[model samples]
Target chain A: MSEVRFGILGCANIARKVARAIALAPNATLYAIASRSIQKAEKFAAENSLPASVRVYGSYDEVVEDSGVDAVYLPLPTSLHVRWAVTAASKKKHVLVEKPAALDVAELDRILEACESNGVQFMDGAMWLHHPRTAHMEHLLSDSNSNGIGTVHFIHSTSTMPTTQEFLENNIRVKPELDALGALGDLAWYCIGASLWAKGYKLPTTVTALPDTTRNAGGVTLSISASLQWDQPNKTVANIHCSFLSHTSMDLAICGSNGSINLKDFIIPYKETSAKFDFTFGAKFVDLHIGWNVRPEEVHVDNKLPQEALMVQEFARLVASIKDCGSQPSRNWPEISRKTQLVVDAVKKSLDLGCKPVVL
Target chain B: MSEVRFGILGCANIARKVARAIALAPNATLYAIASRSIQKAEKFAAENSLPASVRVYGSYDEVVEDSGVDAVYLPLPTSLHVRWAVTAASKKKHVLVEKPAALDVAELDRILEACESNGVQFMDGAMWLHHPRTAHMEHLLSDSNSNGIGTVHFIHSTSTMPTTQEFLENNIRVKPELDALGALGDLAWYCIGASLWAKGYKLPTTVTALPDTTRNAGGVTLSISASLQWDQPNKTVANIHCSFLSHTSMDLAICGSNGSINLKDFIIPYKETSAKFDFTFGAKFVDLHIGWNVRPEEVHVDNKLPQEALMVQEFARLVASIKDCGSQPSRNWPEISRKTQLVVDAVKKSLDLGCKPVVL
Candidate 1:
């Protein structure tokens, strides 16, 4: 109980990153790792340079049932998340699952329910939210003083990563059975999360999928664009586009009444050591419509640890509070995850119905 | 003729800028000015430092019919463009009309037809297109080498300018009968033009207005967002949003299969002396998804003349080609202007029909 012992399920590529994060987190230990094949688990451990005392298992159930494992990091594919996450939570292990937590809200609800019933901490692996840069951006957006960016009127976020032909044809993400939401679930989740995060997690009144959506043969979306709208008073609209068919481009811009903020590398900063964003206040063209009177101010945030490690450390702190101090699990992380999942579900539904607006 | 003699009509606010451009254009001479009242025209001429030889007229017809004037710059409201532009063209005066050229494509066709019959040069006053930075951007986008950004898959452009309460309530743009298209005609025209310009002026297959649209009491759109789609071989999607309710923000981002480009000041550069854009080729997250493998390269394009002056100079050069060299009028400008207006009309139709997709 002195340290948060973490067990990772699956040997997915993303799991390798999370495993490194768990090892680097000051309050966490990489206690166990499990793959379908014990040899594969051993090979992963050898390749990642895990400590000699780390346990290797052939089945995910063994990792969950191990009494020494205080928490589970589930980096399984979308189709496998529900089964493993629910199982880990039911076994009284805190759950930290990769994004697109489940195929849909219904499946994600079951995982949340299990965690609630078992009194275990639950957090989605949206690492960017834990970055110091994200906190700085939130401050810029929420500041109400003279220099602050006023009420946000619009937000646009995009996350795109082109895949190789071989991967597109064979990757689990493009297969409906493996990841039914395809690019919408894998990439759009980040865009949707960003839109929500900018608005302080306020759910939009409506969600509409743009007609430019493309889907693979298995009816899994390969690329999608959507707009989220808030009614009356605030009168805000946000647009998000995600695709596996374009080059890697992760950008987010928030425009307020008094100013705007732009981030070129929102999902992942251009560098781990430092991140930068630009903020412009009272931008106006000079007399005679020649040029702007003021240019955007560039702001930078420095971080010593990678965002994933920060995410793991933050999750471990919550688990420690629950395990050592006998405190209740933090509801903030789970609530934000649920809201993001709900918006993702709405976008999928709107796309399914031929780009119709889904009232949220 | 020693120079292309230019006449200014309506004495509108934008006319002041074009008047200075006319004076700066070496091949053009500001010969006359006209307004409904001769006093306003006289005031405009004096305020803009017009030469003593510049004559002031009370009626627009007087300026167009003056034997000394060889070209006319029409900077009137949307509803008045068709009247003044057609009149000027019919008088055999080469025409340069302000944006939202005639409120709709059908009206613009009449103005274009008048120029065709008169055998006079025709151009829409989209001044940014004349900026040296624009040609630089076009070069980067069309380059197909290993270091070049690849084929574009999507584009997003926005032009939003917040107006004061008094202006919103009393400005001619907010009046239904004057600038009937409101923000869509004034601001969204820039967004649509940027999209069309990025695609080499090829029109989209369909245009759909996003549901997040607002209209004022006078039945004029105050804010709007729309998506333009191209089908088949070169699948592309572009989104454009324009509003009079948000702070000044003009942005354009083009995402290609192998690279991408971003510009914060597309409509008007932050500075007239030099403008810059960022281009990234093969941008991808580095190991552990901690940072980008290649950051965007900042490219700056320097301009000795302001964009508006360059626009006037280009128009005068084309006018001189017909007058001094007996060359045919350049159809490129009018053609691009027509395509932009067509897309604007489609967006208006889609918004009118409750956000339905309108075929181009």
Candidate 2:
């Protein structure tokens, strides 16, 4: 329980961030890094300033074979997620997979089953959910608090980043053979995940892709918009926009009957140690509807570590509990990842049906 | 040209605000007020502290008939706009009608035609359009400057207010015979208008209503969500959510290829004299992607007069120009209102078709 050793598979650009995250996480250690080539693994370790004690492996199998590594962080391409994640899980290593979790729900389910069978902790690398600001917003969204935002009615979120022409043409994300889902996988994972999180992981009854789906020449989505509608206990609708052709933006706005919350930098904070969101409660128009009675109050939350490090630390804590105390792997994180992947699949299905509504 | 005389043709709650706006507008004067009964008009005048010099009339016709009144502000229900607006135009009075200018674009067209034939100016009472903050935002949205938000790709806006059950059942806005369109007409007008304004009045290629449309017992839409897609010289998508079921919110966020802008109180400012919006230009994730390199900068703009007063002043300026300088009536305001109404009709049509996409 002293430290859950993390072995990172693949030398993806994102893996470098996770490497730093593991180094920052007090409860987690950067034990090993693997790439298709030993030189690549060694170069990644050097570039990220990994300590000499960290192991460099030529193959992902070597990291999985190392019994000292308790967890594997899979930052591989979406197409290779199922193979590597399932292999890591089968090796009794807890899994922290980068999102879009998999190319589709089927692949995600395979990885999930492997983790469940092996009694390994599972979580997707959605670092924002680990931020202190997210917890602060969740407190306001809780149903037990009478003063919180009343029964949620609407949620809007977007994850967009401008990509250069060269990146669009050559990057792994937009390449059909590497990241087939393209922007829908790379960017919309955040937006769709945020929506599901806001709704407490209640799967939507229907998903409809907007007509504005833009595709690259290789039939990969470059930009897309979709809506998820929940028709059960209380009707709620969530709209998400994800694109690789827009300015960098990560906006999340949630409105309930009695209040609303909004944050512009929901995916990544402007600063590493602090974040803020705007919350307006019991807002009413002043007499004659000239102005609001109250303005949105800025609520600031500070964190001792970056959200990525928090994610690593939390994953390590869960893995440690299971390894040391013989506790079962918590289903909470896996369930969240499953539900988010299910919605992602639904969105893709909706698009496949020519922007028609896909009933869940 | 000293001051264009103004007359109000209803005793609705909003009329009180416009009466004050007319009084505060330097180039406009509150010359007359009208209601179904002289006693009601006199009571409204007394309650709103109207000056004794302001005339009170028993019927809307009297306000139109008064040769001294240069313009009439029609704050009547949506059902009454076409009739009153046409009558005022025929009487050589410039018309300033409250939004959802008419129940449908057909009625709006008739009203516009009447104003055109009579050589009288026409403007919708969308007060937010006249705010100094709007002009400042417009400056940032302009394509002339390379530093502004470049080629807007997505726009998201919401106009929602929590309504009491009694209001949902009895308020004129939700009553089938009074406003008819309910939240779509009353609240969505601002959101739809905002989308159009951000896009420089370019009509969307298609409109699709989300399945979360909620209706009152009288079959009036109480809440609705819709997306407008523009497929032309550039591809842009806009999502709008308007409801009488959620907490008060008027949010507008526009994301472009180079920058983004966001404001919470878009329809009405949180304060009367000043407003602020967050603008982030050239935003990029820092190396390692842990956080953004730039945060949204708060841009504040102040106005000497309330937005409503500024609206009245602008309308009066146009009216005076026509009356004193023998200038032609400007088509800009009427065209803006017409485009907005067209989109409103498209949204309603899509809802009527069971949330299908309606081609514009």
Candidate 3:
């Protein structure tokens, strides 16, 4: 609560939003920022209103070594997430790695272990789950008034690929270590986090990955799809999909038992709403939208990045949990590591095994 | 356990398959057949090699009221499912009604309540879950070998449409009681059953529906889409876009952490095994089918339904579950009822709200 001091690892666009969020949070402050280039870092430091005492490190190692930082926010490429996060944690700084902490699971597990052994905090920066919209979604989904809309079964989240590529987006499209998964690693985490949060964090019992690893200028995914099941008290299954090759997906589509809620275009201001299907006893008619039975309506617009803000606040909240909550730390480390690895491993398996299901 | 003596409520196509399954399973028998004409019922009874003592009824009411029967299979039009099933339950008989048991939630609820209160059983004759293919899907998704592929995320299941005359022959499409829901109700249930059974029987917390209710000379959906979320231990989700309008949609696409599996024209089998999309995780490059992904080298198909045989074994299993395990009745009643009503209500609400998320 003592002005949660924060440091950012890059000057990525999202980093700007996240930094802005840190500044906006009443108890949070953007105290430091680092980049390979001093000019960009200086620009970010100045524009974001960082204090004079707040320093810019040309090297991330310097930033990670900085004792002034309490939490390190990593906003680097998918491939670099693990290396930097583990380094930050080893230096005893709490880490908030960007969504998809690593390109694959083995690396993710290592980072998680480093956090545990080093006794530092670790959180995936999937901020959407922290948004009020998500809280409302959880409330809407769990409310009995929705009647039999029991489990949340699917999430379709598509963040349109940036038309204007940044200078740093190299090797994302066609490299062995860094391949098509950049899109999946980036956009998919939202769907994963959203679904995980919706199901009250039920771990998937199984996973099967399907990737649209179409090479070259054709780009990432014409469309990619995957499926998994959860074994728990209620027993649920899910399918999540992400694509960076199309203009079609603009939102998250959440389908439940009793009805459906669409968080239209989560990355921008777009249509958002909930819809129900009609079925009365023996005398009613089935509902139809226009000529069809399904359609979307806008109920809210998230013009601001509340999720990023809440994510930092939640990180703040986690610090409290580590000190006072149950015997376990604020986050479920082993579980998160396993699940994260499960996703990345699933992706690798798909490329190796030709995209059939494998048990988690 | 005493036999679950099933009395047929119609001479519909699916009834014959159920009858055959009844003959194969323990503790169940197809005792009678009912139609508008006793001749049609008698003919069906004879063709299927039923006992001469098997009664033929000219009206559905007689079959529901028969004291010799323990349960009645209601395969009448969508409009009549609730009326007959509830009445049969009221008469202290169990009911295994066909899909989309009612066009709306109110009627479906009434029927459910009636059956629950009467201490009789109720189930939807949803067949796919009873098939072994889904079990394989469950296995592939949960196993760890498939992990590098990432989590199973998205799937779209589609079933093709029948012509105007064909739809009118089916009660679900032309039933005045169903009104606008028609095709959405028809096609949505299969996807519902798949998602529910895949989840080990849990309802969705969020449902987003978008329907194409255009009648296209057939008074049914030309295209329909829905977004579902099942956020349990393993975060999962799906987008279901179907068409009673498409000439063909014998496809179910599922992606996983390590791979993906697809049932080719499952409900209505295509002519060749080559029509399938059975995939798993691996590191080699794979070819892509124009419309669907093709990874046949590593594909493993659990069961491929010959359109004719799809319902036969499932109906048998439902009968066996009811008779052999009276304590639990049908293994899938709660799941079936919950999913059926969910889809029905979702369709109604989507129509009313113009395809928006209707919180359960």
Top candidate on DockQ is 2
TM-score of the A chain in model 2 = 0.99
User: Which structure is stronger by lDDT: 2 or 3?
Assistant: 2
Question: Interface RMSD values for the candidates, listed in order?
Answer: 1.1, 0.7, 14.8
lDDT of 3 at A94: 81
Summarize candidate 3's per-residue lDDT along B201-262 as a digit string, tens digits: 55665565543234444445544556566555454555565544333333465554344555
Candidate 1 global lDDT:
0.89
Predicted structure 2, TM vs. truth = 0.99
The stretch of ten residues in a row with the least summed lDDT in candidate 1 chain A is A140-149
User: How accurate locally is residue A23 in candidate 3, as Cα lDDT from 0 to 100?
Assistant: 73
CAPRI quality level assigned to candidate 2 from its DockQ score: high
| TM-scores of all predicted structures | 0.98, 0.99, 0.50
**What is candidate 1's lDDT per residue for A224-293, written digit by digit as tens?**
8899988845888888889999988998989988889987899888987788999988988899988899
- Better structure of 1 and 2 per DockQ: 2
Candidate 2 on B5-66: residue-level lDDT in tens?
99999999999899989989999999999999999999999999899999999999999999
Question: How well does candidate 3 score on lDDT at residue B128?
Answer: 52
**Docking quality tier of candidate 3?**
incorrect
Residues A297-326 of candidate 2 have per-residue lDDT tens digits of 999999999999999999999999999999
User: Whose TM-score is higher: candidate 2's or candidate 3's?
Assistant: 2
